[model samples]
Target: MASSLLIMQARLASSRLAQKALLPIYAGKPSLLYAMQGVYGVADAHVLACDVASFSSFEPIAQEAGFAIMAGDADDVLARFAHVAKEYKVDYVIRATADNLIVGQELVRLALDGAIDSDADYFCFEATAHGSGVEVIRRTVLLDAYANASSPFEREHVTPYIYGHPQRYKVIKPVVESRFFAPDLRSTLDTPEDYTRLVEFFTHRAFPSQTIIEEYIAWMRSNLYQMSL
Candidate 1:
């Protein structure tokens, strides 16, 4: 079976922060560029699809970055996702958000690897609605999600209908061994403070290839000489 991933993303159209993706972190690069590079570091067979009303700005950026861009309905995200997944005929699907500047590659790969071992219908790293890291789905599971869910929440958001109604399918959450922590390390891009923290991290090292906690801890410990305080 062909294991593939599709990154569901769009430009900064959110009410919280306008044009967050295009916001510059450091080294004259946008947050979305770092995100794309981070994702590219982990999996190879993946594409980014952004729901822009017109192919005016983001299209060029995605094209230049070597990603396949598609203009589709912004509201009905599940329908868009289902259409793309079916067209690709992917056995496994990886769901990534553009806001996660501190997205974990090793964690994602680890979770995906574990999901394949179990009989779970859905694989996710975090369980809660706030910290939902990422999700991986078997084609069968995704098809079920699309087929069964048809509500306002599902239509606006992508996977909540399936995830919210857990009794319908078996969901998997993978584990990793680690120690040490901090009070808060901004992971996703939403407000200016989050962007500032990311800028602080990026100042140390431009577009790190490591996960959030690892990179933050490394920056704190000064283990990585390439990054400067």
Candidate 2:
């Protein structure tokens, strides 16, 4: 079995929502904790990747969650990911973001399995209702992207180089079959409204990320129907 690593990239600094990861989501627990919890047992190892300046701020949180931390260039997120992937000797990597709290184990597993079964260089969900999703890529493919990708967009947003260059890499966007397929629903915490909605979500009794997502979808559909009526 090829070793896979799940890397959650996060930072305290944010132009839209500063320190959003530290925001209390469930009973005073930080949003990062919940994000970390969502992917437990889905990877051989898990690491929280952040910049050096923000390392101290995130170290305690990572420690609390039993996750390792890797600090790298603040703007070069792809470099950070590549470094971690190389250091861990991981054959595959599942990329995630901290503000995306709904990236549950199921989604991670789906991406990983799709990449392995299809022999794809990169794999991701086609249309996710939530901002939560996983990107699975081989370490060699990531290293190649890091080396040849010139655009800041490609470096900062990782995996774009691979997907953008279809001739060089085989990409797969797996369709996620679910009753709750609300692609319009925003699950990422990038704005005040997103934070407020997430707070409301966490206030309810805790459940797995998948269940929370399903419930949210159901609620959204019903609310839309009522509004139309």
Candidate 3:
């Protein structure tokens, strides 16, 4: 069985929503904490990858959330991922973003297990606007891409080199069957509008759980109906 690691890439320098990771989505917990908790048991190891300059700001937050921390190049995300994969000796890696608070653990497990069982170079859930999702990559493939990829976009986005070269890498995108397939719903926290919707959904409810995406969508639909009255 191949060992897998989950790396949540985060920084305080987002252009649209500065420090969005540190903002609270429920109660007083930071959004990073919620994101981390969402994938708590889905991987063998979970680490927060950030730039050295921002390590100080992310350390305490990561510590509080019980996540391992790694610091690397701010711009070269692919290099940072490869470095972490090598350092941890993990054969596979799951890439996650900190702003995605509603990432489903079930979907993450399905993607990772599918990648490992099928020996795929890359695997991802079909991108849906209903909620965030994760991607799985083989460590050796990622390292190769990092060593040879020249474009800044490929380096920054990570895994693009592998998936972009379909002839070279086997990629799998699993379809998730769920009634919560509303691709029109935006569940990721990217802008002030997104944050506002998140706050409204989580305000009086218990800290949003794994079913947050479904719950939020149901609530939005209900609210719309009430307004039509």
Model 3: ten consecutive residues of lowest lDDT: 220-229
Candidates by lDDT, descending order = 2, 3, 1
Q: What is the TM-score of each predicted model, taking all chains together?
A: 0.82, 0.93, 0.91
Candidate 3 residue-wise lDDT, 1-229, digit = tens:
7888999998888899988988987878888888888787778898999988879988988887778999999999988888888888888899998878776677678778889898899998773544467889988888888888889999999988998998988988766556445555677888888888778877866653666656766887777622110
CA lDDT, every model vs. true structure? 0.64, 0.82, 0.81
How high a TM-score does candidate 1 get? 0.82
> In model 2, how large is the Cα lDDT of residue 105?
79
Regarding lDDT, does 2 or 3 come out ahead? 2
Best by lDDT: 2
Clashing pairs in 2: none
Comparison by lDDT, 1 against 2, better one: 2
Candidate number with greatest TM-score: 2
Per-residue lDDT of model 2, residues 1-229, tens digit only:
8779989999888888878988888788888888888787788999999999989888998987778999999888999998998888878989989988876777688789889999999998866765767899998899899999999998899878999998889988866776535576777888877888778766764645556567666655665622110
Q: Candidate 2: where are CA atoms >4 Å away?
A: 207-210, 223-229
